[model samples]
Target: MSWMTLSLTLIFVFIPLLLSKTLNLGLERDTIVAALRSTVQLIAVGFVLKFVFDSEHAVFIMLMVLLMIVAAVQNARHKGKAIKGITWKLFVTFVVIEVLTQTVLLGLHIVPATAQYIISLSGMVIGNSMVLAILFINRFTAEVETHRDESELILSLGGTPKQSINRQLMKSIQASMIPTIESQKTIGLVQLPGMMSGQIIAGADPVQAVQFQLLVVFLLLSTAAMTSVLLGFLSYRSLFTERMQLMKIDVE
Candidate 1:
């Protein structure tokens, strides 16, 4: 029996029970719904990836990046609606981080100048940073609400809005980065991370795949850290008014 067939069969057979167990952790319908949605989405994406990889058209790649941006922006907005302009903050942050990471990797001759590589690289940054945005924005908004009095105190005491919110913004950025930073520390010892494991299972050389996964982890760390800080900074500004007064940082 082929390993691929067995793996695929087990994936289907096991995921639902796995999801049902995860749902037992008080997520209610979340794990079941999310697993189902992911199954469908990944199947659709597999075909889309086939097309994106087949052609090197600049327009097609640009569209894929745009879709990524849209996803990130929407996620940010959903998380940070209280302060407003979270989408714009995330959009700007991604534009800067994604372009810089993609450009530098190409410029440094680290990655092949291929459409698939570029798309995967950009998608990795965009996708992973979405996780950071989700964490930071929600916590930032929650922290703002939790410490509203402290924030207002600063504003009332002649502190500029930036000065008032500086600490909170920093904390949010720090919180967003901790998971990625910790995961990297635990990669080989604590777990076989998804990418390297997948590559090795798919017949790639183990050593080479480990190296590639290391490179990928570093890329994600850089991108997500930078994006978290930048978006946190920008989103904090949106929590203030034109006169440097703190606006209601309440989550909408």
Candidate 2:
């Protein structure tokens, strides 16, 4: 698409802004800021990705992946800041997700170990993991708050921290994973995924695009499961005291 065509896409943005104004939803400023930031950030990322792809240096590729993990951690940490050491927890979760996924993909020769494929897949894995982390933490915090008395009663009855929080933790993990699972159930029938649709628009064979999209779908399923389970396990421990008592968590 030309610059002019891209500029014309602002019509889509304006539609939301107009609705927000008419309905007095008070989202105009946020809508405008998000649109501007997305445009600027994506353009900057496009240039950086081009340079990294052209260089094909392992150092540059690793650096790009590191940046993604750092950014993902930063964005996800806020949702769980009430839990101690949430920043590092998110960092570790994203790194593990990246390492585990790449190991399987590259070890089996499922995809080329090139900057293009590695970075693209890393972006998807890290992004999805970050969202899952946020969802899990949000729900987990709410659960803890709601069940504080029950948890304390369990602790008073000599139950371990893990036993006390097991129900809430499992519920949070399952809740966070539901969206990813449900979306996959209706993927092709309800809508075409962006990656597959983009490839088809770029004149790639439909069969090839579908195959690639399926790979991504499978990768995302693993990403969602690992992210929720790992982050939940890592975070739940922080909600307790060394004395096996439930610590008070103030959730915002």
Top lDDT prediction, candidate number: 2
Per-residue lDDT for 49-139 in model 2, tens only?
9999999999999999999999999898888878999999899889999999999999999999999999999999999999999999999
The alpha-carbon lDDT assigned to residue 32 of candidate 2 equals 94
What are the per-residue Cα lDDT tens digits for candidate 1 across 129-191? 888888888888877777878888988899887778777877888888999999888889999
* lDDT per model vs. reference: 0.80, 0.94
Best by TM-score: 2
Q: Which regions of candidate 1 are displaced past 4 Å?
A: 1-36
Where model 2 places Cα greater than 4 Å from the true spot, the runs are none
lDDT of 2 at 179: 99
Cα lDDT for residue 213, model 1?
89
lDDT for 86 in candidate 1 is 66
Model 1, position 169, has a per-residue lDDT of 78
